[model samples]
Structures are given as C-alpha cells and as structure tokens.
Target chain A: MLTRFENRPHALDVIGVSVAFGEVCVIDNVSFHVDVGSTLAIVGRNGSGKTVLLKALIGAVRASGTIRWAPETRIGYVPQKLDIQRDLPLTGRDFLNAKADVARAPATDAQRVAGLVNLSQSIVDQPIGTLSGGQFQRLLLAFALVGTPSVLLFDEPTAGVDEPEEKSVYALIHQLQQNEGLSVLVISHDMTQVQASADHILFLSHHGSYFGKTADMLNSERLQELHGPTVAHLRE
Target chain B: MTYATGPGAFLIPLGMAAAAGLMGSIAVMRRMALASDALSHIALPGIAIALLVHVNPFLGGLIALVLGTVLVWAIEYRSRIPTDVVVGVIFSAALAMGSLLASGDELIEALFGAPNTSDSFNLIGLGAASLVIVFIVRYRSQLVIRLVSPDLARPAGINVPRLDLLYLLAFALTIALGLRYLGVLLMGSLIIIPAATAMRLGTNLRTMQTISVAIAMLATLSGMLLAPVLCLAAGPLVIVIAASIFFLSLAVRRA
Candidate 1:
C-alpha cells in the first residue's frame, strides 16, 4: 500500500555532490537529504560551501553532483539583494500588496508574500528604497515566500536583524513546517537558532564533517574537532 | 519653405527638447550614460556622413552606435579600466573625430542653426524619435531605471547588456537624427541633468524615470524657446538650464 502524506511528497536527495570554483574544491563530494516537514540547518565557518551549496541547489551554480527532488517541489529562494545602488522601484505595498505598479497587477504574489513575512499593515505604502535594514531583510524573506514552495532555502535570513525579529522569523518558519509540512533549509552560524529551528543538521566544513539528526551529530568527534577551537568564542 | 522664417522652425526646439529629456535621464543615472554620451558625440558626422552619401543619417548613426557598443563590450569583457572610464575615453575620441569630419559651413545647418529640418525631413525626424522612445519603453524600459540583480538580467530574464545594446541603438538613431536642432557639442549635458534631478527627488526606478522625463521635457522646451530669442545655441542653452536644475536638486537633497 502506498503511504499517505498530509502534504505532497517532496524530498531533496543529494548524492556525492562536489563543487569547484577555479582552483578550490568547495563542496567536496557531499551528500544529504531533508525529509518533508522537517528542517535542515547547514552550519559551518566562513567560506564553507554552505552558501555555495545553496547556490548550486538553486541552479545558480553549476555542480558535478545530482540533486533529485520530487516533481511537486516548490523552491522559495531568498537571494542577496543588497547592491550599492539598487534600481528596483518596489514599494512596501509592492512587497505587501506584491505589485510593482498599477500597470502590473501583483495580487497573488502579494498574498503569498504577505503570508510568509508577517509584515504589519503600517508600512504597506512606503517606498522600498527607504526601508530600514531589518525591514529590507524581511522584504527578501517575503520575496522567498512568494511562491509558497515545498522547499524554502534562506541564506543568512537574520544576519543583521535583531534578536526578537530573528525569533519570530524562526517561529514562523517552525509554524510553516508544522502546519504545512514544508521542508525548510536554513544556513546560520547561530547555535541557539539551530537548536530552536532544526531537526537535522548538516555540518559543512572544508572536510565533510557530519550529517544526521541534529542531536546525534553534534557530539560526533569530527564535529568536536572542528568546533573545539571556536566553541568558547561562539557563546555570544 | 522660407529659409529662416518658416513653419519648420518649430522643430529646432521640439527636437532639442526630446533629445535633452531622453538623454538627460540616462546621463544622471550613470548606469550607461557614458555609452549614450559617447554615441551621441560620435553621431555628429555619423548622421552627416550618412547624409553625404544621400542615405538616412539615422541609420548611419545607428551603424556607428552599434560599432561603439561592440567596442565597449569587447574592451570591458576582455580588459577593463572599468566600463565607465572606457566609455568616457571612447566618447571623447569619437566626438573629436566626428567633429573634425563634419567641420564645413554646410555642417553648420545640421549642427548650430538647424535650418535643414524643413517638410518631410522634420516629419521623419519627429516620427523616428517618437518611435525610438516607444521602442525603448517597450523593449529597453529597464535601462531607463534600475533592476533587482545583475543575475536577474540573465537570459530568459532582464538582461542588462542586451537591453543596453538595444537602447543604445535607439539612442544613436535619435541623437543622429536629432542633430537637426540640439547640435553635437552640447548634447551630452541634456542627457545627464534632468535625470540627475529626477533621481534626487524620487526613490524608486519608475519614479526616477518619470520625474527625469518630465524634468527633461521642461528643460528642453524652455531652453529651446529661450535660445533663439536670446540668440544662443539651443543645445547649450538647454544643458545650462538642466545643469542649473541639477544643482538646485542637489541643494534640495542636501537640505
């Protein structure tokens, strides 16, 4: 008998994936998966393939490995949008209402974005260029949620954001996974955030360190070796 | 048609206004302003060269513009001092060469006085410019403003390089044909000031585009009307006015 899932079956299976940029081998033959309705926290130091791996999965980066996903997989991508001078003429309502202009109707995009970011109605009509840093990050997050995809990939979603905002964002992510059974993939250096939000963990070091359930993989010796020197300074 | 006093005299200001408003917006944005400026400069005799052969100056200018775009792309894609500096040097050199090629007294009619725009030529110039603006808006509209990401400009997306090339063709055609009124030496200023002013006043790309066009139109019209009455070159007159507006905007932004 075929097993019944509450939501559609969406799984990300990566087998022996290796990536190279010029002379450096970044993601060295890594492999892992995140079951539907669960969270995968990718943790590592600066320059780990965490970001590179995410880019590869998004098809922005060329990869030597295979990433096979279920046919119904919806990818909600949150890419970096902070250039010195951004030419996008988006407004808060454009983000909240999700419309670029009256000439271009954005109702469906707006509703989906509104669902994910949890933006208050206070700033809907505000010009996007004038938004605060935190607001901008949230806007990118909302951008990711626009398609209501099965798999949500976020790169440093809460880097410059404050603690409260970070918690709420994580909480919302948790709620989405619990309610909709969405597969969440988040990259972060924050241990507390990982513990709060992830069920499984992928330690992305230069060397492939650990990949398994979050609790079991943390105590592994390879991980301990990698995390040993930095653990004291990471408390903050 | 009467040589000095005729119905076609209206084109002097109208053409100047269009060129100034359109190019000014591009210049102030600084995205592809240098390229636009370079093409406009090179298009001096670019049109005259075409006119000399009894072909369309607009098409001739377009050929030059295409060549210039290709050159810039080649240099930047291969070796670079950054595209902006490359564009500036190219603009200066091309304009100098074009001016030298187009220096005779008959060239004065195409450049300074614009007595050449009589009957069908006026119609052609006006119609062609309007079409180019429409084309840029429909096809190269993003070049007028900003985009989300450079990658967003990739294939099956809003490709910046392609948009730039297409926009430059239209720009070359307009500037080459627009030579009937605005002249060459003073063309670059018009493309920069109004857009710069608009940028200071607006936050989004769309707002910047709209405000820049509006400002350019105002500057172009007023300058065109004042130049002949004041016995000044229409192109330079418009640039000065646009520059004044730009400073005013900068002062306002600072305040």
Candidate 2:
C-alpha cells in the first residue's frame, strides 16, 4: 500500500553544480531542484558523471556551484555500494548505530530502525559481511533512516539486488516516501525503474543533459541527440 | 646461560603489544597488515643512522616510520598506485640504507634487539599506554565509520583527514614503542598476528578488540616466560608465539 506524504515545505536547490578533475569536467554545470515529498532520479550511462553529481549534492565532492539546503534540512545518504571487508566483524545493528551516541540506548533505536526497514531483529543481529546483497541493501537503507532525516539520497539503489528484490525494495521506498513526506534523490541506470519510481528525471550525458517530468524526459531533443540509439527504449 | 633480562623484558613488550594490538584491529581490517611490515623495515635505516650519531634510536625510528607512513598515505591518496607497492619501495630503500649504514654486530642487534635500560623508561611506556587507551576510547567509532566508507563518514561530519593522521601517528608510535623490544624485522608481527587471530575468533567489533588485546598480551607474556627456558631472544620468541596463536586460531575455527 502506498502511503501519502503529509504537507511539508522542504526544498533542495542546486545551481550550476560543476565538478572538474584536472582537465576533465566530470559534472559540467549541472543544476536541479528537488521539492519535498518527491523523488528525483538522476539517469545516465556509465562515466556520465551521475555519481559525481550525487557526491556533489552532499558536499562530499568540491564543486563550483551553489547547493542550498533548506533551513533545518537533514539528509540521509545510502551509498551505492559499501566495500565491506569479508572478515570485518561489524553487524547490521552496529552499522546502524555507528553515528549514534553510545549513551543513547542505541540497541533499542537500532531495533526500531530495523523494523522500519522490514527486517527482523535476528537479521539485524547478523554480521553485515555475511548478509546477502538484498539484505545488505536493506540494512544500508535502515542505517540511513536511523536519524529520521527529511531527505533521503540513494546511489544506484538496486544495483546488485535481484529483480524481484529490486521491485520490493522500490515498493518499500515508495511507501516510505508517501508516509514520511521524504524527499528522495537517486542515481539509477535502469530507465524503466526511473520512469516508474521517479516523479522527475534528470538525464545526463557527455554532450548535454535534461531535467523535467519523467513523462517528458524521453521527448527532450537534447537527450535524444545525446543518447541517440542507446536510449531509444526510454521513449516507450 | 643466565637470563640477562630487566623490567624492560615485560614492560616494553607488553606496552607495545597493547598498542600494536589496537592498531592491528584497524590495519588488519584495511588489509594494511603488510604496511606495518614495510613501516618497520623503513625504521631500520633510521635505527642504523641513530646508532651512528649516538641519538635515541627509538626517536630516529619513529621519525622515519612516521615519514614512511605519511609518504604512503600521500601517494595512496593522490594517485592510483596500490598501497603495498608504494610501501614496498620504501621498504626496499630502507633495507638498502640500513645495510649500507650498519652490518655485523650492529645489524644483528638492530634486527634482534638489545637490552634497553633507562631510569625514565617506565614513563615512556605509561605514556604510550595512555595514548593508545585514549585513542581507542575516543576514535574507535570514528575509525570504524571511516573504515566502512570515507564518503559516508565525511557527510556525517567526521574529520576524516584528522582521524587518518591521528591513526598514522599512533601506528608510528606503536612501532617505535616496540623498536627496543621486537626490533625492525619482528615488530610488525606484533601488529598483525593478534588481529588475525582475533578475526578468526571474534563475532563483532567489541569482541574483536577484546580478543586482539588478550591474545597479544598472552603471547607476549608466554613468550617472555618461555624465553629463559628455551634460551631464545624474547622479541623473536614473542612473535613466534603470536604466529603460533594465529595458526592455532585458524585450526580452532576449522575445527
């Protein structure tokens, strides 16, 4: 069941976001706005700077532009992939509690978050290194949700999950967005998922880019010329 | 032969073991175990130089190892070169310099350790112990977060660079603390073996830290205890015990 978001005034304004490494301008003058309770999907092929744009949004990467977060805006970021060492003894609960104060009764807080992510207490107790890809992804989501941030950012949200698991994860995300009035910004490679999950699309390519309603993204002449044959299916 | 050992026999190795064990939990997790070996080797030339100049060899070794750590960090941070490769270069250069500076008895002493005695030595040991404790208490969580991903940690407002420099300094100090006891060739074992053993035995971060310290202390104590009986040097013996414990933990896990 999709829950509807409550009315909340929240916004993210990124203006002329540009990132360059030496001679290469990876994210060249990209800009967009995300309204509260909306999902914005950033789409691009590999090496098109989608990830760089995400990093720029969080101030993790230095960029020559303005990223204005609304006053009192809290952001939660779920990395596309965490390089978890196979031998590391960190558990799901520990991962969620990493940023929390130890004196704050993290065990109970972690359990609450685990439940929010639809994970059982036992699964949260298991070593993170031993978790399956889908399970780990859910744990990452739970970890992000620990602080109850108004904005949730995900990078390649379903990169390694199976098809069925991916759908379920997206459904969960949709429910959370509607229920929490959370603003979501995600980078995705799957155009079909982006179309279904995102309210707006930001399509990026080496030559040019477009940002508009999901329904209008494929019709943009700039995207058509830049993406050409590789993205023709997006029109459907 | 009568056992020619002093308070340093226990204090130096035990203090070093504690510091090394803590550092090991981070280093082993990052797969930088061999970097410790490289850093220790990089200290050998410094030790040789210190011997020639009649300066405190521990200070010289600490400076050299810290420089090596900084170089490795800088190179790994700036370029795509693998950490072990950069460390390997430093290790080889230090080895060549060490050989050029000292040989025969001096080389053997530098490699196997000699009796160290100073009226103020206990203060140094106490200081190292306090610093390691404070480090583990204050930054253990931050270190773990950074270990998971710098991208995540940075957004969470962790001072990643400061934390990194702090860890490296602690690592350098740990290696230097062990220099008079374990020597260059054997010191890195103290930093890796316990953590490996703990990884095999532990189920979480807290247990891993506890077990790492326990195993390191046990190995140091047992090796010192057996040193007199076997007529072997304590530094090398402690390392042997630690390795034995690691293999034993492996066997135990398999069982």
lDDT of 2 by residue, B129-199 (tens): 66876787688877887888888776666787678778877887888777777788887888899998888
Whole-model Cα lDDT of every candidate shown, in order: 0.63, 0.80
Q: Which CAPRI tier for candidate 2?
A: medium
TM-score of each: 0.76, 0.91
lDDT of 1 at A224: 69
Residue-level lDDT of model 1, residues B1-255, one tens digit each, is 113344466554465455556555555554655555555666555656776787765566657766876777677656745667777878787767666666576466445535334445566667766776676456533442234443322211244566655655666566655555555555555666676677677765467667777777777677666766887766666678888888887766421
- The candidate scoring highest on TM-score is 2
Candidate 1 achieves a global lDDT of: 0.63
Report the Cα RMSD per candidate. 5.1, 3.4
Once superposed on the true structure, which residue ranges of model 2 sit more than 4 Å away at CA?
A: A1-10, A102-107, A218-222, A225-235, B1-9
